[model samples]
Target: MNDVSFLPHARLDDLIQLLLTQGFRVIGPRVRAGVIAYDTIDAATQLPWGWRDAQAPGRYRLEQTAGSRCFAWANGAQAIKPFLFAPREPLWQARRAAGCFEVQELVPPPRPLAFLGVRACDLAALAIHDRHFLGGLHPDPYYAARGEEMLLIAVNCTHPADTCFCAATGDGPQAAAGFDLALTELDDGFVAQAGSQEGRELMQALVLAPATPEQRAAASQAIGLAAAAQTRRLPAPERLRRLYQRLDHSRWEDVGARCLSCGNCTQVCPTCFCHREQDVPALEGEATVHERQWDSCFSAGHAWLHGYQVRPEIRQRYRQWLTHKLAGWQAQFGRSGCVGCGRCISWCPVGIDLTEEVEVLLAEAADGA
Candidate 1:
């Protein structure tokens, strides 16, 4: 089967219908309360057509255009992370019996999901999560169940936000891999490619014609322009690996002065995987439910130990998060945790740009040398 095909804008609903027939709950990007967010969709009309977003440090705004594009925006406040690594979930339930207690694991049943318009940076983050949750010595059954059968339909980025730096992270502007189907949106239609057996079967079912050379070239050129337009960048991995050694760097104190300690960066970050667990007792005292929710190193409670906080100061917490995200993550996962999606920059109330912080921190080290 030919991997590359042209899907006319009009026939997009046909593809959604086919996924529905295959028992997938199709989720796509939609304009919700003036923001492009992922939601369930039954037809192509639900997509944010002719909509674009302008993003900057501590700012995001929606703009309407006279175009027919559905994915002209960069990304939303949240990624597919919440879908797999649920913000809050019950781990187990304990029932009090006549003589003993019975525990029931609360692993959720797998639901087939088809996500449309996944960005390349998000795909890279998803790969890091796969390594964290599934490639560990003890696999996370909860995350595994949710992600095992998920279908990824990637949309190559052509309109990157000013805050976006996926190109510097080597993760974006084009869909390189980790997708079933990849689409490059054009004004008239989309240039689609199948990356998996299931994706090939679906393309065959769509019966789309092979994309013309002109269409393919246009898509490639648009992605290239998008890449070139990004002004933000992160230091190379080699320099980032030394970030932990700068624990007492003055930049930490400088950034900490403006930091809110609100953990918004960790929450918006695509690859931050800290979580906390607690047990909730039932009102009747007959049961207790153990639940886990997302956590952040920015929280004072995260470093709590023996009734004392290890990172009590805001500067220490800020340093901890930055060093761990850029340096410690490499030691543990063989890659930096940041995928350069820039959600941390735009969603932050104070707009603490980690890329800017890293450059300043590393530049000082080079000058001192």
Candidate 2:
């Protein structure tokens, strides 16, 4: 366990088979409908090998590369969020029976899942989610059931997209913790290290050979290159925390004018946790299923109070989201909500970049001072 091991490309499938033998359903990145997405995979061939993604503000395209590395791509549209924090789920059910109503709390059945190729930025976001969902006095049973038996296999990032800024967030290019196992992909294979007892046990089963000194050096060099290649970055956390002080900044209006208010940013964001709950009645009116679905601050109903809308304008809604994500989140959770994965920028229809907006707003503030 002291020395890192090398998992050859040829024996990569053995890792998947080992996980399956241990009662884990393996999920990994694969090409589906022209995009790299995380899905259930039973073998190594399902991974998006020899592929690279080109990403920018409001743009993403996947292209094939000659290299045979499986984890050469930066990221996809979705993170591991959906696996834990489901987009939609039933909360409870009420049945009308014998002159009384019976209520039953609903929780998903436990299923051991092994997530493969998790990036450092996403690992950071996942920690934030752990705080939100499981770190409260009234812990969420639904989130707990799914999270309890999960295994994370992190892959250090080697290909950062144009919009990536995890380096600025102090989250990535390398995964420091929160993984059972960590892998660094090289041309011939992956340099693997175990971070947990479960990972160490699995490593023994794989029977991998100790990684050579050159392979370890190459892995380090590749991660360094990825960190250097990132061109986008956020302002310092303290600087971003001051966003609330500039409520009347004209930049808000400028960005709001171009904003779509479509909620794509919240949907793609790994840490945004707004949701709304409602009851869906059965056709016969005999039973009702209460369900919770993801929501966004941009929605008109999100800020509604009694009968009046708290934030009627696009500028106000946008300001609320930015302030909470950068400032209020620190007060609530001791850190900013954004992990700087850049999904919000790439998935936005109009290509709104939060980092660019933060720089403009802070620059104007400094000029005024």
Candidate 2 local lDDT, 1-369, one digit each (tens): 654899999999999999999899899999988789999999999898899999998899999989889998889999999999999999999999999999999999999999999999999999999988999799899999998899999999998999999998999989999999999999999999899998888788888899999999999999999999888888777777778778889999999999999999999998999999999999999999999999999999999999999999998998899989998999998889989899999999999999988888888666444
Per-residue error at 322 for model 2, in Å? Answer: 1.0
lDDT of 1 by residue, 1-369 (tens): 789999999999999999999999898998898788888999999999999899999998999898888988899988889999999999999998997999999999999999999999999999999998999589999999998789999999999999999999899978899999999999999999998998898899999999999999999999999999999988878888878778778888899899999999899888999999999999999999999999999998999999999999999998989888888888898888888899999988998888899988898676444
Looking at model 2, which ten-residue stretch has the lowest summed lDDT?
A: 360-369
TM-scores of the candidates are 0.98, 0.98
Local error of candidate 1 at 264, Å?
1.0
Error of 1 at 187 (Å): 0.2
